[model samples]
Target: MTADEVFDDIVDDLAGRGVSAGKMFGARAIMLDGKAICCLKRAEFGVKLGAGSAAHEKALALPEAVLFDPAGKGRPFKDWVALPASQSEHWPTLAQAAVQAAH
Candidate 1:
């Protein structure tokens, strides 16, 4: 699926569980309990799955995943996972984990 398709799927799936979609930093973001769990920024997908958690470590283990730092070459956000297109298939699952981790 394309980026738009992926974003739609995530938004739809999350909505079923009471999460909503909104704009964050000019990108599409999944909002749960008023918090933004995941977002699509410039073709990259980002998830706030909590730093040091198993899910966070698992995401970082993927070659397509990295630390989310909007500004280049800086200390990355500790609780965010930046995912590349290569890991598209895992988006849904990771997005879910991010939501669960948020609580």
Candidate 2:
């Protein structure tokens, strides 16, 4: 499936589980309790899994994963990771972790 399709599936699944769809940085995002859990920018899946958490470390270790910097500046969001579509297989799992972290 294409990146957009994969992202849509993730959003649909999360929404079924009570997560709400919203916007973040002008990109599509999934929210929980008014807080963003994750966002999709181009083919990147930016997720908030909490800095220094096991899930965050694991995600960063993935190929092409990096700290999310929406503005393209040196500063990056400590709790967010930008995962490329090449790592899409891990998207669903990490997305769930983001939701759990938000709780």
Provide the clashing-pair count of each candidate structure.
0, 0
Question: Which prediction has the highest TM-score against the true structure?
Answer: 2
What Cα-based lDDT does every candidate model obtain? 0.86, 0.90
Model 1, 79-99: lDDT tens digits are: 999988778888899999987
For model 2, residues 1-103, the per-residue Cα lDDT tens digits are 8878888888888886779889999988888988888988888899999999999999999999999987777888999999888999999999999988987
The candidate that wins on lDDT is 2
Residue 34 of candidate 1: its Cα lDDT? 85
Please estimate how well model 2 matches the true structure, expressed as its whole-model Cα lDDT.
Answer: 0.90
Candidate 2 Cα misplacement greater than 4 A, ranges = none
